[model samples]
Target chain A: MAIQDIRNYTGQITQENPQIRIRLNEELHPRWAHCDMISRYLGHLTGTLDLEKLEKSEVAELGDSVNYVANELLENAIKERSGGSIEICSGAKGHTVTLVVSNRIEAAKSEKFKASLQKLFDGESSLEEKFFATMEHNEAHPEAKVSGLGFLTMMIHHGADLSWRFESGEPAHPGRVSVSARLTASVF
Target chain B: MNEGNHSTAGPETDPVVSGPEYLVRFSRATGTVTFGGTLRLNSYDEIKSMVRAAVEAIGPTGVLTLDVRQLKLLNSSGINLFAGVALSARSSGTKLRLMTSSEYSWQSKMLGTLRKLMPTIEGA
Candidate 1:
């Protein structure tokens, strides 16, 4: 396959200036627990921002959203990656908090991912409908592995602006996929 | 896993499924399954059997109330599991009631989605 660099953006495009970047390599065999720990840590770190003016509930909500988004992104990376390190970058600029997670995936899987994204971005069904439909389908089919609900939850419930970058056709690393989720600070 | 039976007047003991970060307790007397702590299991399969067992314990009659007020976090896999449980309860002609905490904004949204899946489900 020829080298292909595909970028798809949804919602709003913001500047790429991340405040914190954490990389987890597959070689170290990162456990599932790490996802929870890292997400909680990020939540605590993000919760401290603008703490004086915000209500306690608002602060908690902000932390929860950050934690949830970060965990979902990290979990997806760990589950889908074929190999290589997973890089996660998070930062807040103005009213938006951006989280980008990148990992190496199999070329074949990238095609499937693209198709899924098409459904998310281009399909006639609203995101709410698609989310419930996906859940119903998964329930009907017990053997089906992927629910595709994580992305939907982030988009529909958390109001996350999501985008993707797929890079392939490289000699050293063939397939790399990066997912960025931008959440408005006030949405929480 | 530590099992703690709820102190209730019944011959049947309540079922408690617990991990380091999470606890799921099903009280037979009240027909309520209370979930607490964070549930971010890597796969739905990890939680499938436990949740299914709770449903089975609920039997085929009366309403099943899932109290998640104390639940701190429920990942997508956990959502899927709960969705499946809701579907099962609906198909079995059992009323389902979800009690969620307003402290977590996501709970309301999640309840809305579950209601869409099974409109008969009651959210409190």
Candidate 2:
């Protein structure tokens, strides 16, 4: 909410730089549209391109497409990038679409989940196999299910074709799992 | 080696494709299709059949209620099917009440956005 207030303030500061204000606003709230709901407000803040000027219909489609792709990557990222909470970063922007899902997994936990997660992302194993294996692992502990397909629309159907990946220890010293994708009118 | 083509798809992904587990009639006066078990992608086909059957059973003159409380997850395909059905019902002059959380802010928001995007779609 504070971030939204900042955008309003920025617009009031300089009418000549409304575009700048829009850019600032985009950075705080990244594009996220999934099944009529945005899982993350993104607090995207701003971007180089000006999507703020786009119509809601256009934004809705772009948001849906962006979300579809992001969710698929996250499915695998959760298993591979274990040990920390996953969060969508607020600093992503694009006229087409943008998503940055970040997960924080402590380094102290087991990395065994990493290999299985990689297999799923790589397509060596099916989602079903991964789910069973993950479920077995979850039998001992609960709430781990959040890491798998919690918000699916963003991952599998982003834009047109789907893509995903995983990374750790970025920006901060703590481990992080991140996945992102985009879609343009020409590409779809 | 393969489990053959007979393998049932996971019901978790697409609710539209999944088949219904059963059909229960609360009353002949007012028919309701209650989605039991897990309503996932793999189960949608059956569910669709059930929906059609329930609607037909109730006939054009009767009303229907879709209870989604037990629904595990309603995916994109499921939502589309719902929109399609709701539109069809509207044109047919049949009333369908969503016996669900209209007051639930998130669900309402979701439904409202969906209705806006798909103008033909309608519901309670």
Reference-based lDDT, residue B78, model 1: 82
- Candidate 1, which CAPRI tier? medium
Residues A1-188, candidate 1, lDDT per residue (tens digit)? 44343344653322255677888887677657778888888888875543335556666776788899999988888888877788887776655667788888887788888887777767588888788888889889988877788998998888888888777745456588888888765634
Candidate 1: list runs displaced more than 4 Å. Answer: A1-16, A48-56, A169-172, B1-12, B56-61
Q: What is the DockQ of candidate 1?
A: 0.51
Q: In terms of DockQ, which candidate is strongest?
A: 1
Interface RMSD of each: 2.3, 15.3
lDDT of 2 at A54: 60
Model 2 CA deviation exceeding 4 Å by range: A1-49, A52-56, A65-87, A90-95, A108-113, A123-155, A160-174, A183-188, B1-30, B33-124
Q: What pairs collide in candidate 1?
A: none
Which model scores highest in lDDT?
1
Q: Please give the fraction of native interface contacts (Cα pairs under 8 Å between A and B) kept by each candidate.
A: 0.56, 0.03
lDDT of 2 by residue, B42-78 (tens): 1234444546655665667767776655543344435
